[model samples]
Target: MGSCIICGTDVEGDGRICRSHQEDVVFDFRGNSPDQLVANRFYRGVVDGYADFGVFVDLAPGVTGLLHRSELDVRLESLEWEPGDDVFVQVTGVRDNGNIDLAWSIRQADREFRGELVHDGDSEWLPTDQADETEATDTAVETEPVEATSETEQTETAPTETEPTETADEPEPTETASEPETTETASEPETESAVEAAAEPADSVTASDERVTVASLGDRVDETVRLEGEVVSVRQTGGPTIFELRDETGVVDAAAFVEPGVRAYPDVVVGDAIRLDGEVERRRGDLQVETEALAVLAGDDADAVETRLAEALTAEARPEGLQPLAGDEAVAGLGEGLLDAAEAIRRAVLESRPIVVRHPATADGYVAGAALERAVLPLIDDAHEQSDAAYHYFTRRPTDEPVYGMDAATNDATRMLQDRDRHDEKLPLFVLVGIGSTTESADGLDLLSVYDVEAVVVDAAVADAETRAQVDTLVSPTLESVDADLSTGALVSSLASAVNDAVRSDLVHLPAVSYWAETPDRYVTLARDAGYDRERIAELREAVALEAYYQSYQDKRELIDDLLFDDGGDLAAHVSAQFREKLETERETASANLVTESVDGVEFAVLDTDAYTHRYDFPPTPLLLDDLHRHHANGDAAATVGIGTDELYVRSTGDLSVRSVASRTAEIAPEADVSTAGRREGKISFLAGERDAVEDAVVAAIADAF
Candidate 1:
């Protein structure tokens, strides 16, 4: 049977004892007697009893020894210790009660064996059964115990053959018997080995098969064990209850199958420190320990929880390579930083001599002069490459100037350069100011000139339509008369309509007018000067005002009134009456002119009813003669012209379709070689009397002769 070297008690043959006494099994040492042995030295021991600290071992046949917990490494506490296992041990001390305490020297012996194996090429098996024979041979050669027990006990034990063969099958049992003697023989080497072994517990635990950490608990999952952690959170579902536990390393979830009465106890809360005894089982990819018993140890530290949360948030907020400084710390303002950069920019602007500050596109606050300089200096540097305008600000001062603050000299210089830029670039200073429609004092004009503003936009809400229209007609023409290259610019009623009308009318060719409802009176002047009528201008003005007002109050009636009419009157009647008078006068004058112009070509005489019928069918000469006879008969007025042959012929027809014809034969004859005057007269008479049948026939004969 296997036994402990120190206690000489029988141990189980499995080469193991209770985990509490494993130190005794692995580090057996011996001396004259257990009482005479020093504490924590080599001793042979048998496992007699078990406790949380260690197993009680018997040294020197009957002397019981105690192996305290501190003497053994943590690896021993995790092993499956049995009572019959063979054990080696070291003597700790003789207690007051005559008990000799023992400790396992396995780690020390293993180190010594490894060292001897490295140098002498001897294995640990030599120390088992052959240990006594090797010691006998050493004693035979040397008389003194000190000289016989040199560090290389392996060399002394190498030649013993008989005991080596006997102990080959039971090396562990033999080791328990001989381990304490070997420790005494090789004390110096063993001491050094123990020191080295103690220094590296990680390597020792790895070398031992008995250490039980989480990594080693895989085989014992059915056995319950205890774990401790703070509760991060808890979740309960229909099947089981899950608890999240966190330690310094990381977080893991532990679950418990709900037994009948387990839920009635105090519920687990977040931030609770708890200890759990459970069997670990794998569910899905995770190792879940099924808790059989749970107990609340203490409450979680609130400060620690907050600290951890803050750390997590900080880790998430950190940029890829940069971290924000913790606690209160001042960073430079953007405006201040730009001002520092603007020194170089100031030099560039000064070199450029003249720079115009145009109105910014966005409606935010105005940019400081220093900020503007910083923004524009780079552009100036680029422009300089092309040998364009050179204008910028320059500084001559020893003191640091506050950003955007200009000294008197610098201000004057700036004004000079700005004026020069205005002249040189032919660009206007765009200023945003409100000019009221009724404010005819031209105070804004003075401000405009001072600011070198090319255009002024008046607020239409405060301005009357008539005033704005008058301003439009007056100011624009006045500017033209004075040879000032000033043009009024304003917005249209609606952006879409404005764009459409601008495109169709080529408004860009005239001037720039943007329609924004924010200012109505200005737009009214703009519309009227652009040739919109007064009523239309008023309607547009109201539309702009309505939109502006709606922007504040959302009033629908105002918008409709602006869209429909200038004032609530009969718009249709007013428009109709004006056009109707003009059209009627035009029609009467046209008719009178037509009658006066047509009356110069014909002559007639009044006749009696019977005579008028008789005279009507006659050609001009005959009709003249018929008229003469009718006038003689009735005393009516008549006229006559002398006839020529070029005159062709004449006849008359009465009003009742009776005809009378008469002509001189020579006058009726076709003209032959007629004078130019005679041909002209004949053509005239032919055209004049062509409707008469006799005149038609005579004109045809005259043409044939010609």
Candidate 2:
């Protein structure tokens, strides 16, 4: 025997405490038999699994209980539980079918049950004879209430050997000297409960008896009901603790003004599974529950709630064998890991985790980012009832360059850190579309990694080996050996479709929009089938390109939506006309004033960007260079180099390394002050005096770099 941790008294074992302190002592049950188990006794258990019907909890080996949805006080999906988590629950029943029913216990934390934990049970504490006597006494006590309140005034009563007790005013010993001491002491057990029941009120309902959902609360206004659910959000508004509670059916705010900003319920926190008894009322044009009582469902009951939620989530399977939007073999082969990437993005939406999409400020990048925005926004709207959830959960930022660099990385880090400190937000999942593929982005990627931020890099560019380690998911062309000339939009459009297959048709015109030249046959057919002719598809490309160039930083969501999704085709037509006019004018100007040369048997058409072209006008430097190269350059291995006062923007028919040129130029013409700037733009800065010597060296350098 051991002494109770509370007021000193004999306990059967070290884990045991006296009956008066039983509620204070949380138990860890070892036995599984319903025969010895006391109904309504809370015990610690592990969450086993979830089912659509409810969560299954393992009390012990061969003992499990169901916390049915009918018993849920909150939304099933709102629960933030993973399997194997510990929780507390009360065993409501061990039925005839051997199905154990559990109720959510509001008291979840050890501090709430502050006494020492005991691992003993009634059967474990008693000998066989003593155990039988205890069981009989409990049975007799249960029947006394019914017997005492009989309709029949003439009641048959079993007589026992006992001395009569005195009135309450002058209480005396109930047992006489002649009475057997053991029998009288045993009879004492029967009267204890009878006396307690008579003293306790009849109308007072047990808090553990009933639980209801928020959806059913509308009909129950002005009526007090017990509810169980996770605290979605806790706001201390200086006047009250407003806990936003969500159940499977709906959400309701439960207000507790007693403690005001002092935290009315100190133990209550966001994501806690709690049971509350409150009167439903309409407050300021919205429904709210004025909480009278609150309990944190802890230990096994908490685990059961989460376990059930997990099971239900598991049962709702992700869509599998999703067909790629692009039906090409190379794209299909590259899509091996696309499904996993999509599921991750989709889960972030459901969890309400913020998503930051970093895409290059190009038509291809804009279209890809737009496709995901189209797919994910609807999901965010559906996942959360809040109208602003999409804005809160999703963000798309355009990169001025194709790579995720230090500048971009610093901006993202600053925003995320501020968000964490100000709003306690979850670190966002960084989705790099058409960006973050080379060694250039390593420093930026490393910065995000320090905070353990998860990232997904989706690019058509063949990423360097080092880039793979910096991201969670790297969907790049290099992974698949088949190096097809696919655009970034082609890759992410299909990935967006996989993220939400329902948006597949909406993305049909994207693949065709990505390729500025030689629009692929497969993608062209896809656009046509979706009712987008060549003219319509070209307009979208031009429209995206136009918008992509102007902001070059912001995600023009509404304008892009009208260009991409609107059937009127007016925006696309108007934008495409402007794009053609500006592009043609720039191309003609570049064609007129261009220096053509050949070195080491390779053709080179160089344009002086600062001297001949409008530096700040329509058709950005990169776009103008691409058009100049394709239109003015010729031969099998031709290249266009736009030489500025210090920088060289190169567009080529083949791979060329500016770093090699920079290294070689330093050796040949060190006075040129050559250095690499942007890898994606193939940008290299050098002195203008070295233009003649630098141009000659670069032509020879391109030959070797290729």
Candidate 3:
């Protein structure tokens, strides 16, 4: 033994250097076992070559180590050491190829040792000659066993660590470690942020936007709401999927994302009713719901949706918390009373006869008062009705008529006279004329005398002069053998003045005897014959014939008496003698011309009855046409009177250029005195041709009357 050369220590045995410094050291005999000598020095060398060819390393200066590649731990492949790079080497064995076998387990052993030193905070021996000798001496007794255990452990553990490290090292370990961690950490935040963002309130989410439903994606929505409506259309786009839902309010679009690995149903079409739940989201400046779930519901579901909408609208329309007043008994009672009054009036108008009934002058004046009393009195007797207040006067006037007189003081006198004439004298006449002058026009002058006769002699004569004149002129010409007496001025004035009074007061005064005929003789005869006892006609005829014949004879005798008898004492006998002589001559002539039904044999005679004798005393009732013209010319209110099968028509002559009042059916007699005091006032005003004013006045009058 000698001192080692690498790291100096005392050497021993066969004149060789120590293992720490065994440069150029070898055994003496060529075929001898080298295991007898202990190799001390471990050299630091480069891996010169690697493969099954062997791991060649410099060992002991010039002596080379040829370690088998298979014997090396596979984990060392990650070291990437090339030629001339330093690595710890040791002598493992003497190979048959005459090369020293080397080991690099010292490098791994050093890493383990350093790790242990760091973890345990311990210092151990460095790889020097003195330390190696000391370590060898300490482990000398167990060296072979320790060495075998290390080899076995290395063989087993190295294979596993080597495979993964080897694959990672082919790229770069630092680059590989950084790439995956970056991706995974970045992706995790995105998922978490999405859930947090979707947790917002619905109002905030839907503000200023429209929501569309995305079918079958309900799970993705954090807050899903329901939309019930009819499906207007479903469409598939190559790039994306969308559908349209329509309700009465409006239409909205539904959209969804096509997930991978899911099959799409293409046959789904439009007009399907569905209920959908979805998230409202923003798309292209509009709020749209991304649908999560969609279901095809029955038609009743759509009906339910509509019902809900209608209920909402109805709720909006109702006034908040308002209710009707309770327990208004008085108001209810009043309403019932009004309804009863209206029913009574309707019944009266329907059931009443055509005759003009006179109103009593004392308590119930005016025909309307009488009619109303008649209608309501029975109801009152039953104890189920009550009467409203009634105002009394001789005649009733429409309220719209102008209030005449200098003042209230002057009105009493005029009204008194009017009342006296209307009730006491029964002389008030209302002449409704159509297209004529005044009621006293020449064509119907004698009308006044007839009305006066009817009024004074027969009592209570109210006539319409205009209607009489129309009969004498237009109606009379159409009838056979009728004559009209048109000359009589005093009678005309009296009748005209009476009619004017009624017109001014807006009162319709009807006559007791209404005589209207198509022929002139019929007009006069009807007037005279009315109220005459038809049973006494034969006696009355003989009286009239004798009186007429005597009067005629007296007229001729008066002419002879005026010339021959200065004193008129024998005039009556002379008249009787002259009447006999004329009768004898007329009888013989009549007998010669007589045939069995001879018309010529009949003696034509004029009557000297009370009607003919006192005809000049009474004013005639005016005709309808004449009254209309008088009112029209004098700018007074007038109406046309026409009789229908069931009712009387009193039309205003104010705006009527046609000059006739027409019934619902046939044309009526223009001369007929159908005028009644209770009739409504005409629209015509005292001032003519003021149609607009008159219309307003008429409407006012009707309202007041009702």
Candidate 4:
């Protein structure tokens, strides 16, 4: 009913593609049935393994077919193929014995396909041909070699007549019999397709007699054991298929190989509860089960496993209470909600689901995301037995804008889809720390919603009304009507503490480090008690702010971690010195260029932004204006405006909305061509010729509105 996301083709089922482009598109093949692959279609395949007979190409997980040597146009050894190299192929046929036949394709590169690749959850480009191929059953008619020789005997009997040479005719049958090993070697590939075909989706089945827990697998080395649980992940090596199977007790890897690079059990997928029988054994140093059989369990037996996991998880996942570091009651009340949110993240780690922390590319955003990362990573390591679990489980990404825009959403979608398709990995829990609020992020959230990706928002910005419906959890002071100037870092630091109470001491200085100026009294008290002096807090703040401005979009992970957490204060001191130098120089120059005027008892300090300030430099106009407003407050009568030809940025000691000023200008100087639209970043626009009138009206409006 809908159009394809790519190619805009009118599609029938699932809005995927039309019949023509389907053959051209590459898919993350979920091996369901051999019939799902259309007849005589080309596919993109990964080189699985090679044998003296031929090469094996993996079309999808648990689904591999063979390319016999005769099917190649050139010698197999001369093809220059390595394991895992992606190549193009054509399905020649599917054997009734449950095997696939592949032919060497002339167009071997992915770029040869004109259609877009439909990658992700399961359809692999497998072509289904008729079960039987063209049979030339005319049967090579041959005369008995003895009869031809007997004709020579008859000629001998004739005594004088000459007979044709029967010797040449006698060798013809031998040549036909020894023509090539092609036909004999063709059936040898069925050895790699040894597993039984799985045709129907099974519902819950009775446990096999050999069933045992994964924890007991190590004890049963060399013994046949049947284990049942969900398929946590599936990975195909050049040699064997490694399936990470997790039962309630623990997780163990089961290695299955019909042949090198061939999918062992084509029907099993991630998230499918399965019962498998394998021989327990050790390879290298780790224990792995040599799988003999695996079946995808369905129905109530599958539901039973999931329900048990859910019940066990839900019990341990919920937090006991709220813990507030801040003394304010409003913050304390919100702390309870933060605890619940923290538990969600902690549970994701325990459940082996990935966590993605998205924050704005500012000092506050970085500190917030880094704080959560610092807290959650250790938990991931403790929860999973693998050393790489921490890296795989936790990710902290810095977004350019403070809103969840389409770009960020698209990036997350693309990565998650690939993981799900290739590795059988689960979707990530999006922990939107500072960058997800307001109606501007609705479209971005809608995209994630399509795949059911969950999000957690912790911010201190004024939230849009629609933002609540978009997120699973929204933690913001403004949303609760708590008029506190807490930064996002400060709020998330509290949540991070609730995530791991042991990391509380490590984050003592983070809240204070998030504030650029006028550090909150509560945070200052906490930082002082944690042994960080006023000078150290300022150094951390300025250092991070300087770093935040330079690469703005990058995570700057290890460097930021060392800056904020290193016991030695050298990094912070060095960076903070340069930070203060640049900011102070810009401030002094901006002050020198300031033009002062007052209208109706209101003061206005207007600076030509393009000339006075280094617009491209550190301390962006907003930060610069904040410094200017604080530094030039001689009884604070009105506001300071940084005027550019295209726009003006305003900062006032009193309550200010530039919209009010633009509205007044429209009435007074309607011919001035002044407008207030597209000014969300606290800036307004006006005509260059109407400067005097716009300024006059702005001053008058500020005087009247405030």
Best by TM-score: 4
Which residue runs of candidate 1 sit more than 4 Å off their true CA positions? 1-32, 42-44, 51-53, 69-79, 88-90, 102-706
Q: What are the models' TM-scores?
A: 0.16, 0.64, 0.15, 0.66
Regions of model 2 farther than 4 Å from truth: 1-295, 308-318, 634-637, 655-678, 685-694
TM-score of 4: 0.66
Candidate 2 structure lDDT = 0.69
Model 4 ranges with Cα > 4 A deviation: 1-186, 189-193, 197-227, 246-254, 277-292, 326-328, 421-424, 478-480, 632-637, 643-648, 657-701
User: Model 1 compared with the native: what TM-score?
Assistant: 0.16
Candidate 2 lDDT by residue in tens digits, 1-706: 8765444588775434567555444456667575555576677788898889888888787788898865653445545546887777778878887888988765453322333232434432211112344444444323222322211111112222233455333222231111122443565543443233222321243443567777687688878888877676654432345676755444566765332122456567767877777677764335677665677788997786667545533432244756777576666776666766786787666444689999988888898899899989987776554434577679999988757889999999999886665343567888998888788788999999999999998887778899987789888776446455788898888888888888888998888989889888889999998898888888888878987998688787767887888649776888889999999888888889888877777777888888888887778888888877766775443788898777778787875666777788677777888877666678887887888788777777876665
- Per-candidate Cα lDDT values, in order, are 0.32, 0.69, 0.30, 0.68
Query: What lDDT tens digits, residue by residue, belong to model 4 across residues 553-667?
Result: 6666667888888648998999999988998999999988888877777778888888888888888776788678788634454788877766677777665666677778678
Model 1's alpha-carbon lDDT is 0.32
Q: Give residue 253's error in model 3 in angstroms.
A: 6.7
Tens digit of per-residue lDDT, candidate 3, span 135-245: 444443221212112110111000011123446322111111101123323342432322232232234333223333233222333355666665544433211234455
